[model samples]
Structures are given as structure tokens and as C-alpha cells.
Target: MSLSEKVKERFRRMFSDVFFKRYILGLWMMAEGLVYDMFDEKLHVIKTLPDTFDRIFAGGDYGINNPTAFLLIGQKANDFYVIREYYYDSRKHGRQKTVSKYVEDFQSFIGNDQPENLFLYPSAAALILELREKGIKYVRGADNTVIDGIQLVSNLLSNKGGRLFAG
Candidate 1:
């Protein structure tokens, strides 16, 4: 099949495996929006601990102890989610280096050629500014109303068993 078809099939399989089995919830509303479309009484919400206390409570040997940031891409009108969670290593890494790594990762994932039909949250503006300094192009976050609209569309499509983009 074509490359686009392959990508769609991969996304379908990943989403089904990762998201279909559970309802997504988060401490912040933005994260909540990531999987809110699938919310159901049977769904389990992963408890979110406060950032400050979470680390303290985690004790030693809990791996990285920092507030991780996420990068999410959702199709406009369709609302299919591709979320990337990134962590900061203040002790050994700087923000610019972290941003550069993320940009590289994003470019590798989506390719150098930009797609016209994509939406991204702008909370990463500082990172985006860094990207702009390095000559990358990207958009910012949508308003809450827009997110709600997309969520509604996503829920309807999911309920109807309508795949966002099939292979």
C-alpha cells in the first residue's frame, strides 16, 4: 500500500491498542482533552498527583522526578490524537537542548515536508520560539471552544465506529 495508507493503518492499530481500552484523564484540563472523547463510566482515570508533592512522595529509585511536558497533535474536525510526553532533566540538560531534541523528534515523525491539515497546542510557545529561531514553522494552541468542538466531533465519530483515516 501507499506510505500514507501505511501511516493510517499504524495509527489505527496504535490508537486501538493504547486508547480504546481505557478512558484518559489528567490533572490539567489540556491533558484531559487528549482522551476525553472516550470517557465512560467503565473507563479508569489515572490519578494525577500534584507536581510538587508527586516528586517528594515518589521516594528514591522512582526514575526521573520532574514534571513532564507533552506534545500533542490532533486532526482538526476529526480529533485523532498523537501525544508525545517529554521530560526535563534540569540537572544535566538545558531548555534549548531539550527543545532541539523535540524538534528533531517531531521532524522525524512527520517528515520535513509540512502537512497543511494539522493542529498543535501552543503551550510550547517557548519551544516554538526556539524552533522559529532555527527556521521551523508551527501553529499554536486552539481556544477552549475549539477544543470542545473537536471533542464533540471525535466522540460522534468514535461512537459511530468511523475511523479518522483508514488505510
Candidate 2:
């Protein structure tokens, strides 16, 4: 199975549980930093997990403070949604070693059947350029409308505004 297929499979398995269904819904919003909570008559927007995850996952490569979460967002062969995420611990290796490990993990997850349409939301320009150099086909997720749509979905999830996966 392709990476996208694997991700969709995982989602299906996880989403079957009520707890995970709620958790994933919450995570979608947390990923986009769109949740607001009331405190002392004041409303505050919560910081999304992606911002922190991106920070820890990008730049300097070693130590527990390093980036641990890597998310792969795209579409699967069956036209189902695909979102895969993995984590790495910098405490186990040096900077170079950890980076290499991440690259290897990324490559393995991607597999050989390269998707004609893949997108990445890299945290840094250097990483983006590096991926380009490696000849991986991708588009910048920052300015992409698809990403914006995901963000909107995330917001709806965070607010607990409606049901998901329901017609």
C-alpha cells in the first residue's frame, strides 16, 4: 500500500473509536491554532499544536527539545483522506544522526510509488529547498487554498460546531 493508503487505513481504524474520533477532531483544530476558551470573562485563542510541533521538529536536531512530530497530509489512491504522523526523539542521537534518521523515516514512509500530487508544509526555507533538491514533487502548503480548507475544517472541529463524517 502507498503512504496515503496507509494513512487512510490508520485513520479508519482510529476513527472507529469514539474517544479517538473526538481526539482527532480536537487535534484538527489544535493543529491549526483555532480554539478559543473562556477565562474570567475573557476569550482566548489557544495555540495550535502544529506551531509548537513545527518548532520542535525543525532547526537544531538534537535533544528532547527537538522536533518530534512529522505530519504527512495528502490524498490516497481510493480518493479517501490521508494524514499520517510520526515522531522522533533527538535524545537518542546527535544532530546529524537524528536528521539522517528523520530523512530515512520520511523516505520509508513515502515508499516507492511516488504520488503525482504531494504537498508539504515545511517549517523552514532550507528544508523546502532541500526537499526540492531531492526531486520530491511538492507545493508550498502555506499559500495553498487546500491548506486553508483544512484549517477551516480544523476550526470547525475545535469549536465542536458540528458532526464529522456524517451525511
Which number leads on TM-score?
A: 2
How would you encode candidate 2's per-residue C-alpha lDDT over 1-167 as one tens digit per residue? 33577776777676533334346444332223323221111112222212211111111122235555544433222122223455665555454333445556666665643444434444445555655566754535443456675666555444344311110
C-alpha lDDT (0 to 100) for residue 123 of candidate 2: 48
Candidate 2: regions farther than 4 A off: 1-65, 74-80, 91-101, 116-123, 139-141, 144-151, 155-167
lDDT of each: 0.41, 0.41
Candidate 1 lDDT over 1-167, as tens digits, reads 33577776665666542354442221223333355444433332223312221110000010123433433333434223332233445545643345566556545555533544323345556656655676655444544466686666566545554323211
Q: In model 1, where is the ten-residue run with the lowest total lDDT?
A: 53-62
What TM-score fits each model?
Answer: 0.38, 0.39
